[model samples]
Target: MEYYEVLENFGQLALACVLGGMIGYERQSRRKSAGLRTNILVCLGSCLIMMMSYEIYKQVEGMTNADPARLGAQVVSGIGFLGAGAIMKEGVSVTGLTTAACLWVVACVGLAVGAGFYIEAIMTTILVVIVVGVLSHFELKKSTRAGVLQLTVYSDNNPEQLSIITSCLDDLHIDITKIKMREEYARNEREQTIILVMEMMLLNSRHYSTTHIVNILQDLPGIHGIELR
Candidate 1:
Protein backbone atom coordinates (compact mmCIF):
# COMPACT_ATOMS: atom_id res chain seq x y z
CA MET A 1 0.00 0.00 0.00
CA GLU A 2 1.08 3.60 -0.63
CA TYR A 3 2.10 5.89 2.19
CA TYR A 4 -1.10 7.92 2.02
CA GLU A 5 -3.34 4.82 2.00
CA VAL A 6 -1.55 3.38 5.00
CA LEU A 7 -1.92 6.66 6.88
CA GLU A 8 -5.62 6.83 6.09
CA ASN A 9 -6.31 3.30 7.41
CA PHE A 10 -4.29 4.01 10.52
CA GLY A 11 -6.52 6.98 11.10
CA GLN A 12 -9.51 4.67 10.71
CA LEU A 13 -8.13 2.46 13.45
CA ALA A 14 -7.85 5.46 15.73
CA LEU A 15 -11.42 6.46 15.03
CA ALA A 16 -12.57 2.95 15.80
CA CYS A 17 -11.04 3.26 19.27
CA VAL A 18 -12.86 6.49 19.96
CA LEU A 19 -16.14 5.09 18.72
CA GLY A 20 -15.74 1.98 20.82
CA GLY A 21 -15.11 4.10 23.88
CA MET A 22 -18.15 6.21 23.13
CA ILE A 23 -20.26 3.07 23.16
CA GLY A 24 -18.53 1.68 26.24
CA TYR A 25 -18.91 4.93 28.17
CA GLU A 26 -22.61 4.37 28.57
CA ARG A 27 -22.14 0.83 29.79
CA GLN A 28 -19.58 1.97 32.34
CA SER A 29 -21.94 4.61 33.70
CA ARG A 30 -24.59 1.94 34.16
CA ARG A 31 -22.16 -0.25 36.17
CA LYS A 32 -21.77 -2.87 33.46
CA SER A 33 -19.03 -5.46 33.87
CA ALA A 34 -17.30 -4.52 30.59
CA GLY A 35 -16.65 -0.79 30.82
CA LEU A 36 -15.04 1.84 28.59
CA ARG A 37 -11.58 0.31 28.43
CA THR A 38 -12.88 -3.15 27.61
CA ASN A 39 -15.04 -1.93 24.73
CA ILE A 40 -12.43 0.45 23.33
CA LEU A 41 -9.85 -2.32 23.27
CA VAL A 42 -12.30 -4.71 21.63
CA CYS A 43 -12.93 -2.26 18.79
CA LEU A 44 -9.29 -1.37 18.35
CA GLY A 45 -8.24 -5.00 18.47
CA SER A 46 -10.77 -5.96 15.81
CA CYS A 47 -9.53 -3.15 13.58
CA LEU A 48 -5.96 -4.37 13.89
CA ILE A 49 -6.98 -7.94 13.09
CA MET A 50 -8.90 -6.83 10.05
CA MET A 51 -6.05 -4.64 8.82
CA MET A 52 -3.59 -7.50 9.21
CA SER A 53 -5.96 -9.87 7.43
CA TYR A 54 -6.37 -7.49 4.52
CA GLU A 55 -2.63 -7.15 4.17
CA ILE A 56 -2.18 -10.92 4.25
CA TYR A 57 -4.62 -11.47 1.34
CA LYS A 58 -3.15 -8.66 -0.80
CA GLN A 59 -1.72 -10.09 -4.04
CA VAL A 60 1.80 -8.66 -4.15
CA GLU A 61 4.19 -8.77 -7.11
CA GLY A 62 5.21 -12.37 -6.28
CA MET A 63 1.86 -13.74 -5.02
CA THR A 64 -1.40 -14.43 -6.91
CA ASN A 65 -5.02 -13.56 -5.94
CA ALA A 66 -6.03 -14.34 -2.35
CA ASP A 67 -9.43 -13.99 -0.67
CA PRO A 68 -9.31 -11.05 1.79
CA ALA A 69 -12.80 -11.64 3.09
CA ARG A 70 -11.60 -14.96 4.45
CA LEU A 71 -9.63 -13.22 7.18
CA GLY A 72 -12.50 -10.82 7.96
CA ALA A 73 -14.86 -13.75 8.34
CA GLN A 74 -12.47 -15.41 10.74
CA VAL A 75 -12.23 -12.18 12.70
CA VAL A 76 -15.96 -12.29 13.33
CA SER A 77 -15.91 -15.96 14.19
CA GLY A 78 -13.11 -15.41 16.69
CA ILE A 79 -14.99 -12.58 18.37
CA GLY A 80 -18.03 -14.81 18.87
CA PHE A 81 -16.14 -16.98 21.36
CA LEU A 82 -14.96 -13.93 23.27
CA GLY A 83 -18.49 -12.58 23.46
CA ALA A 84 -19.85 -15.89 24.66
CA GLY A 85 -17.45 -15.85 27.61
CA ALA A 86 -19.03 -12.62 28.80
CA ILE A 87 -22.56 -14.07 28.97
CA MET A 88 -23.73 -15.83 32.15
CA LYS A 89 -26.79 -17.21 33.86
CA GLU A 90 -27.75 -16.29 37.42
CA GLY A 91 -30.59 -18.36 38.80
CA VAL A 92 -33.55 -17.60 36.57
CA SER A 93 -32.05 -14.35 35.24
CA VAL A 94 -29.30 -13.83 32.70
CA THR A 95 -26.70 -11.10 32.80
CA GLY A 96 -23.89 -9.69 30.61
CA LEU A 97 -25.93 -10.60 27.52
CA THR A 98 -26.16 -7.00 26.31
CA THR A 99 -22.54 -6.33 27.09
CA ALA A 100 -21.53 -9.40 25.14
CA ALA A 101 -23.64 -8.26 22.22
CA CYS A 102 -22.02 -4.85 22.25
CA LEU A 103 -18.58 -6.36 22.22
CA TRP A 104 -19.41 -8.48 19.16
CA VAL A 105 -20.74 -5.48 17.26
CA VAL A 106 -17.71 -3.44 18.18
CA ALA A 107 -15.61 -6.15 16.58
CA CYS A 108 -17.60 -5.76 13.41
CA VAL A 109 -16.97 -2.03 13.43
CA GLY A 110 -13.25 -2.70 13.69
CA LEU A 111 -13.43 -5.07 10.73
CA ALA A 112 -15.24 -2.42 8.75
CA VAL A 113 -12.52 0.09 9.48
CA GLY A 114 -9.86 -2.40 8.38
CA ALA A 115 -11.75 -2.93 5.12
CA GLY A 116 -11.77 0.87 4.60
CA PHE A 117 -15.54 1.10 5.02
CA TYR A 118 -15.30 4.27 7.06
CA ILE A 119 -18.89 5.37 6.55
CA GLU A 120 -20.37 2.11 7.76
CA ALA A 121 -17.99 2.02 10.71
CA ILE A 122 -18.97 5.49 11.89
CA MET A 123 -22.69 4.84 11.47
CA THR A 124 -22.52 1.57 13.33
CA THR A 125 -20.67 3.20 16.22
CA ILE A 126 -23.36 5.84 16.57
CA LEU A 127 -26.14 3.25 16.42
CA VAL A 128 -24.43 1.16 19.09
CA VAL A 129 -24.07 4.18 21.35
CA ILE A 130 -27.78 4.88 21.02
CA VAL A 131 -28.88 1.30 21.51
CA VAL A 132 -26.52 0.20 24.26
CA GLY A 133 -26.36 3.58 25.99
CA VAL A 134 -29.76 5.23 25.59
CA LEU A 135 -32.09 2.29 24.99
CA SER A 136 -30.73 0.26 27.91
CA HIS A 137 -32.03 2.77 30.42
CA PHE A 138 -35.54 2.54 29.07
CA GLU A 139 -35.37 -1.23 29.01
CA LEU A 140 -34.31 -1.21 32.66
CA LYS A 141 -37.18 1.07 33.59
CA LYS A 142 -39.70 -1.19 31.93
CA SER A 143 -38.43 -4.25 33.74
CA THR A 144 -37.90 -2.56 37.10
CA ARG A 145 -40.15 -3.64 39.95
CA ALA A 146 -41.20 -6.62 37.83
CA GLY A 147 -39.86 -10.04 38.83
CA VAL A 148 -40.68 -13.56 39.90
CA LEU A 149 -41.24 -14.24 43.60
CA GLN A 150 -40.54 -17.50 45.37
CA LEU A 151 -42.65 -18.64 48.29
CA THR A 152 -42.63 -21.58 50.72
CA VAL A 153 -45.59 -22.32 52.92
CA TYR A 154 -45.90 -24.82 55.74
CA SER A 155 -48.87 -27.09 56.48
CA ASP A 156 -49.43 -30.06 58.78
CA ASN A 157 -50.44 -33.53 57.50
CA ASN A 158 -49.91 -32.40 53.92
CA PRO A 159 -46.26 -32.66 52.97
CA GLU A 160 -47.18 -33.19 49.32
CA GLN A 161 -48.50 -29.60 49.26
CA LEU A 162 -44.91 -28.32 49.44
CA SER A 163 -44.14 -29.84 46.04
CA ILE A 164 -47.13 -28.05 44.49
CA ILE A 165 -46.00 -24.68 45.85
CA THR A 166 -42.46 -25.15 44.54
CA SER A 167 -43.84 -26.14 41.17
CA CYS A 168 -45.81 -22.89 41.02
CA LEU A 169 -42.67 -20.89 41.75
CA ASP A 170 -40.99 -22.55 38.80
CA ASP A 171 -43.89 -21.67 36.52
CA LEU A 172 -43.48 -18.00 37.49
CA HIS A 173 -39.74 -17.97 36.69
CA ILE A 174 -38.96 -17.89 40.39
CA ASP A 175 -36.08 -20.23 41.00
CA ILE A 176 -35.00 -21.25 44.48
CA THR A 177 -31.41 -21.11 45.49
CA LYS A 178 -31.93 -23.08 48.72
CA ILE A 179 -34.71 -25.06 50.26
CA LYS A 180 -35.05 -26.64 53.78
CA MET A 181 -38.12 -28.33 55.13
CA ARG A 182 -38.70 -29.89 58.55
CA GLU A 183 -41.45 -31.64 60.42
CA GLU A 184 -41.97 -30.92 64.11
CA TYR A 185 -44.46 -31.95 66.79
CA ALA A 186 -45.45 -29.81 69.77
CA ARG A 187 -46.42 -31.21 73.23
CA ASN A 188 -46.23 -34.75 71.78
CA GLU A 189 -49.83 -34.33 70.67
CA ARG A 190 -49.17 -35.34 67.06
CA GLU A 191 -48.92 -31.61 66.22
CA GLN A 192 -46.75 -32.42 63.23
CA THR A 193 -46.28 -29.16 61.38
CA ILE A 194 -44.21 -28.50 58.27
CA ILE A 195 -41.58 -25.82 58.41
CA LEU A 196 -40.39 -24.40 55.10
CA VAL A 197 -37.30 -22.20 54.76
CA MET A 198 -36.17 -20.94 51.39
CA GLU A 199 -34.22 -18.21 49.66
CA MET A 200 -35.02 -16.28 46.46
CA MET A 201 -33.30 -13.77 44.23
CA LEU A 202 -34.93 -11.80 41.43
CA LEU A 203 -33.49 -12.48 38.03
CA ASN A 204 -33.93 -8.89 37.02
CA SER A 205 -31.96 -6.26 38.88
CA ARG A 206 -34.39 -3.39 39.07
CA HIS A 207 -35.79 -0.87 41.50
CA TYR A 208 -37.82 -3.15 43.73
CA SER A 209 -38.81 -3.47 47.35
CA THR A 210 -39.30 -6.29 49.80
CA THR A 211 -42.97 -5.37 50.00
CA HIS A 212 -43.46 -6.06 46.32
CA ILE A 213 -41.95 -9.47 46.84
CA VAL A 214 -44.09 -10.01 49.90
CA ASN A 215 -47.26 -9.13 48.03
CA ILE A 216 -46.51 -11.64 45.32
CA LEU A 217 -45.88 -14.31 47.90
CA GLN A 218 -49.18 -13.47 49.61
CA ASP A 219 -51.06 -14.02 46.37
CA LEU A 220 -49.73 -17.55 46.03
CA PRO A 221 -51.98 -20.28 47.35
CA GLY A 222 -50.89 -22.21 50.52
CA ILE A 223 -48.28 -19.57 51.31
CA HIS A 224 -49.50 -18.63 54.78
CA GLY A 225 -46.08 -17.14 55.61
CA ILE A 226 -43.26 -15.75 53.44
CA GLU A 227 -39.82 -14.41 54.21
CA LEU A 228 -37.24 -12.93 51.79
CA ARG A 229 -33.72 -13.05 53.21
Candidate 2:
Protein backbone atom coordinates (compact mmCIF):
# COMPACT_ATOMS: atom_id res chain seq x y z
CA MET A 1 0.00 0.00 0.00
CA GLU A 2 2.82 2.40 0.90
CA TYR A 3 4.87 4.01 -1.94
CA TYR A 4 8.20 2.75 -0.56
CA GLU A 5 6.85 -0.80 -0.09
CA VAL A 6 5.45 -0.77 -3.65
CA LEU A 7 8.84 0.33 -4.97
CA GLU A 8 10.57 -2.41 -2.94
CA ASN A 9 8.21 -5.07 -4.31
CA PHE A 10 8.71 -3.91 -7.90
CA GLY A 11 12.48 -3.91 -7.35
CA GLN A 12 12.40 -7.58 -6.39
CA LEU A 13 10.31 -8.41 -9.44
CA ALA A 14 12.71 -6.51 -11.69
CA LEU A 15 15.69 -8.37 -10.21
CA ALA A 16 13.94 -11.67 -10.79
CA CYS A 17 13.24 -10.72 -14.41
CA VAL A 18 16.84 -9.72 -15.06
CA LEU A 19 18.28 -12.89 -13.49
CA GLY A 20 15.82 -15.19 -15.23
CA GLY A 21 16.47 -13.38 -18.50
CA MET A 22 20.18 -14.12 -18.20
CA ILE A 23 19.52 -17.83 -17.85
CA GLY A 24 16.99 -17.80 -20.64
CA TYR A 25 19.41 -15.90 -22.87
CA GLU A 26 22.01 -18.64 -22.53
CA ARG A 27 19.48 -21.34 -23.42
CA GLN A 28 18.22 -19.24 -26.30
CA SER A 29 21.73 -18.87 -27.66
CA ARG A 30 21.97 -22.66 -27.64
CA ARG A 31 18.59 -22.85 -29.45
CA LYS A 32 16.97 -24.78 -26.62
CA SER A 33 13.22 -25.43 -26.45
CA ALA A 34 12.74 -23.55 -23.14
CA GLY A 35 14.25 -20.13 -23.65
CA LEU A 36 13.80 -16.37 -22.95
CA ARG A 37 10.13 -15.65 -22.44
CA THR A 38 9.40 -19.04 -20.86
CA ASN A 39 12.00 -18.59 -18.16
CA ILE A 40 11.14 -14.92 -17.56
CA LEU A 41 7.47 -15.76 -16.99
CA VAL A 42 8.34 -18.59 -14.65
CA CYS A 43 10.55 -16.35 -12.52
CA LEU A 44 8.13 -13.43 -12.60
CA GLY A 45 5.20 -15.63 -11.58
CA SER A 46 7.16 -17.15 -8.70
CA CYS A 47 8.24 -13.72 -7.46
CA LEU A 48 4.66 -12.45 -7.52
CA ILE A 49 3.39 -15.46 -5.58
CA MET A 50 6.11 -14.96 -2.97
CA MET A 51 5.22 -11.30 -2.59
CA MET A 52 1.54 -12.26 -2.16
CA SER A 53 2.55 -14.67 0.58
CA TYR A 54 4.27 -11.87 2.46
CA GLU A 55 1.26 -9.63 2.02
CA ILE A 56 -1.06 -12.29 3.40
CA TYR A 57 1.24 -12.73 6.39
CA LYS A 58 1.08 -8.98 7.14
CA GLN A 59 -2.74 -9.08 7.06
CA VAL A 60 -2.72 -11.90 9.67
CA GLU A 61 0.21 -10.51 11.66
CA GLY A 62 -1.83 -10.30 14.91
CA MET A 63 -3.06 -13.92 14.52
CA THR A 64 -0.88 -16.71 15.88
CA ASN A 65 -1.77 -18.97 12.88
CA ALA A 66 0.02 -16.92 10.26
CA ASP A 67 2.83 -18.65 8.30
CA PRO A 68 4.36 -16.39 5.62
CA ALA A 69 6.45 -19.12 3.95
CA ARG A 70 3.59 -21.63 3.53
CA LEU A 71 2.57 -20.35 0.10
CA GLY A 72 6.13 -19.70 -1.12
CA ALA A 73 7.12 -23.26 -0.18
CA GLN A 74 4.65 -24.67 -2.72
CA VAL A 75 6.52 -22.91 -5.52
CA VAL A 76 9.47 -25.27 -4.98
CA SER A 77 7.48 -28.40 -5.77
CA GLY A 78 5.03 -26.75 -8.19
CA ILE A 79 7.91 -25.79 -10.49
CA GLY A 80 8.48 -29.47 -11.40
CA PHE A 81 5.78 -29.24 -14.07
CA LEU A 82 7.67 -26.55 -15.93
CA GLY A 83 10.95 -28.39 -15.44
CA ALA A 84 9.48 -31.61 -16.84
CA GLY A 85 8.20 -29.73 -19.87
CA ALA A 86 11.75 -28.74 -20.75
CA ILE A 87 13.08 -32.32 -20.61
CA MET A 88 13.18 -34.74 -23.56
CA LYS A 89 13.94 -38.42 -23.86
CA GLU A 90 15.32 -39.91 -27.09
CA GLY A 91 16.37 -43.58 -27.18
CA VAL A 92 19.78 -43.81 -25.49
CA SER A 93 20.29 -40.07 -25.22
CA VAL A 94 18.24 -37.80 -22.98
CA THR A 95 18.51 -34.12 -23.81
CA GLY A 96 17.25 -30.93 -22.13
CA LEU A 97 18.08 -32.01 -18.57
CA THR A 98 20.20 -28.89 -18.10
CA THR A 99 17.41 -26.74 -19.50
CA ALA A 100 14.97 -28.27 -17.04
CA ALA A 101 17.41 -27.64 -14.21
CA CYS A 102 17.83 -24.06 -15.31
CA LEU A 103 14.09 -23.55 -15.09
CA TRP A 104 13.94 -25.01 -11.61
CA VAL A 105 16.87 -22.93 -10.35
CA VAL A 106 15.58 -19.75 -11.90
CA ALA A 107 12.32 -20.27 -10.05
CA CYS A 108 14.30 -20.64 -6.83
CA VAL A 109 16.22 -17.47 -7.64
CA GLY A 110 12.93 -15.63 -8.13
CA LEU A 111 11.62 -16.85 -4.79
CA ALA A 112 14.84 -15.73 -3.13
CA VAL A 113 14.54 -12.24 -4.61
CA GLY A 114 10.88 -11.94 -3.59
CA ALA A 115 11.71 -13.03 -0.04
CA GLY A 116 14.44 -10.34 0.15
CA PHE A 117 17.36 -12.80 0.08
CA TYR A 118 19.21 -10.64 -2.41
CA ILE A 119 22.66 -12.15 -1.86
CA GLU A 120 21.54 -15.72 -2.38
CA ALA A 121 19.58 -14.80 -5.48
CA ILE A 122 22.45 -12.89 -7.09
CA MET A 123 25.02 -15.62 -6.33
CA THR A 124 22.76 -18.36 -7.64
CA THR A 125 22.18 -16.39 -10.86
CA ILE A 126 25.91 -16.01 -11.44
CA LEU A 127 26.55 -19.71 -10.78
CA VAL A 128 23.72 -20.77 -13.10
CA VAL A 129 25.10 -18.66 -15.91
CA ILE A 130 28.59 -20.09 -15.43
CA VAL A 131 27.33 -23.67 -15.36
CA VAL A 132 25.15 -23.22 -18.43
CA GLY A 133 27.66 -21.23 -20.45
CA VAL A 134 31.11 -22.49 -19.44
CA LEU A 135 30.94 -25.95 -17.85
CA SER A 136 28.60 -27.32 -20.56
CA HIS A 137 31.29 -27.15 -23.25
CA PHE A 138 33.85 -28.75 -20.94
CA GLU A 139 31.54 -31.69 -20.28
CA LEU A 140 30.79 -32.07 -24.00
CA LYS A 141 34.48 -32.27 -24.93
CA LYS A 142 35.08 -34.84 -22.19
CA SER A 143 32.17 -36.96 -23.40
CA THR A 144 33.58 -37.16 -26.94
CA ARG A 145 36.51 -39.15 -25.58
CA ALA A 146 34.36 -42.04 -24.39
CA GLY A 147 32.06 -44.34 -26.44
CA VAL A 148 31.00 -47.90 -27.22
CA LEU A 149 32.38 -49.94 -30.16
CA GLN A 150 30.42 -52.79 -31.75
CA LEU A 151 32.56 -54.94 -34.02
CA THR A 152 31.60 -58.01 -36.06
CA VAL A 153 34.34 -60.05 -37.65
CA TYR A 154 33.99 -62.99 -40.07
CA SER A 155 36.88 -65.44 -39.81
CA ASP A 156 37.59 -69.17 -40.37
CA ASN A 157 36.91 -69.90 -36.66
CA ASN A 158 40.58 -69.07 -36.05
CA PRO A 159 41.89 -67.18 -33.02
CA GLU A 160 44.50 -65.17 -35.01
CA GLN A 161 42.13 -62.39 -36.00
CA LEU A 162 40.93 -62.05 -32.42
CA SER A 163 44.53 -61.88 -31.26
CA ILE A 164 45.37 -59.08 -33.73
CA ILE A 165 42.25 -57.17 -32.72
CA THR A 166 43.10 -57.29 -29.03
CA SER A 167 46.74 -56.46 -29.76
CA CYS A 168 45.81 -53.42 -31.83
CA LEU A 169 43.49 -52.09 -29.13
CA ASP A 170 46.06 -52.74 -26.43
CA ASP A 171 48.82 -50.97 -28.35
CA LEU A 172 46.59 -47.95 -28.84
CA HIS A 173 45.89 -47.74 -25.10
CA ILE A 174 42.18 -48.21 -25.62
CA ASP A 175 40.20 -49.54 -22.69
CA ILE A 176 38.00 -52.58 -23.19
CA THR A 177 35.00 -52.63 -20.88
CA LYS A 178 32.79 -55.60 -21.88
CA ILE A 179 32.68 -58.07 -24.79
CA LYS A 180 30.08 -60.60 -25.97
CA MET A 181 30.61 -63.19 -28.69
CA ARG A 182 28.19 -65.33 -30.65
CA GLU A 183 28.68 -67.71 -33.60
CA GLU A 184 26.44 -67.56 -36.67
CA TYR A 185 26.34 -70.00 -39.58
CA ALA A 186 24.78 -69.65 -43.00
CA ARG A 187 23.07 -72.86 -44.27
CA ASN A 188 23.71 -71.97 -47.92
CA GLU A 189 27.32 -70.85 -47.35
CA ARG A 190 30.26 -73.12 -46.44
CA GLU A 191 32.09 -70.64 -44.12
CA GLN A 192 30.96 -69.98 -40.52
CA THR A 193 30.91 -66.46 -39.00
CA ILE A 194 31.96 -65.08 -35.63
CA ILE A 195 30.05 -62.05 -34.36
CA LEU A 196 31.75 -59.96 -31.70
CA VAL A 197 29.95 -57.25 -29.76
CA MET A 198 32.54 -55.18 -27.97
CA GLU A 199 32.09 -52.18 -25.71
CA MET A 200 35.25 -50.08 -25.87
CA MET A 201 36.38 -46.71 -24.54
CA LEU A 202 37.72 -44.65 -27.41
CA LEU A 203 40.41 -42.05 -26.73
CA ASN A 204 40.46 -38.89 -28.80
CA SER A 205 44.13 -39.26 -29.61
CA ARG A 206 45.73 -38.65 -33.02
CA HIS A 207 47.19 -42.18 -33.04
CA TYR A 208 43.73 -43.75 -32.77
CA SER A 209 42.03 -43.78 -36.16
CA THR A 210 39.01 -46.04 -36.71
CA THR A 211 39.80 -46.29 -40.41
CA HIS A 212 43.30 -47.53 -39.67
CA ILE A 213 41.95 -50.11 -37.27
CA VAL A 214 39.51 -51.41 -39.86
CA ASN A 215 42.26 -51.68 -42.48
CA ILE A 216 44.54 -53.61 -40.13
CA LEU A 217 41.74 -56.01 -39.19
CA GLN A 218 40.94 -56.59 -42.87
CA ASP A 219 44.59 -57.53 -43.59
CA LEU A 220 44.49 -60.47 -41.16
CA PRO A 221 44.47 -63.98 -42.69
CA GLY A 222 41.09 -65.81 -43.05
CA ILE A 223 39.16 -62.63 -42.29
CA HIS A 224 36.15 -62.82 -44.61
CA GLY A 225 34.33 -59.63 -43.50
CA ILE A 226 34.61 -56.87 -40.90
CA GLU A 227 31.90 -54.56 -39.61
CA LEU A 228 32.02 -51.79 -36.99
CA ARG A 229 29.03 -50.20 -35.43
Candidate 2 lDDT tens digits, 1-229: 7999889988999999998899999999999998999889888988988889998998889898889888878998999987898787642235688898898898888888888998999899999999889997886676565544456666665545456666777776664443444455644267544543323334434455677766776786666677775
Off by over 4 Å in 2: 140-207, 212-229
Off by over 4 Å in 1: 60-65, 143-225
| Per-prediction backbone clash count | 0, 0
* lDDT tens readout by residue for model 1, 87-125: 876423467888898888988998888788889988998
Every model: Cα RMSD to truth:
6.8, 7.2
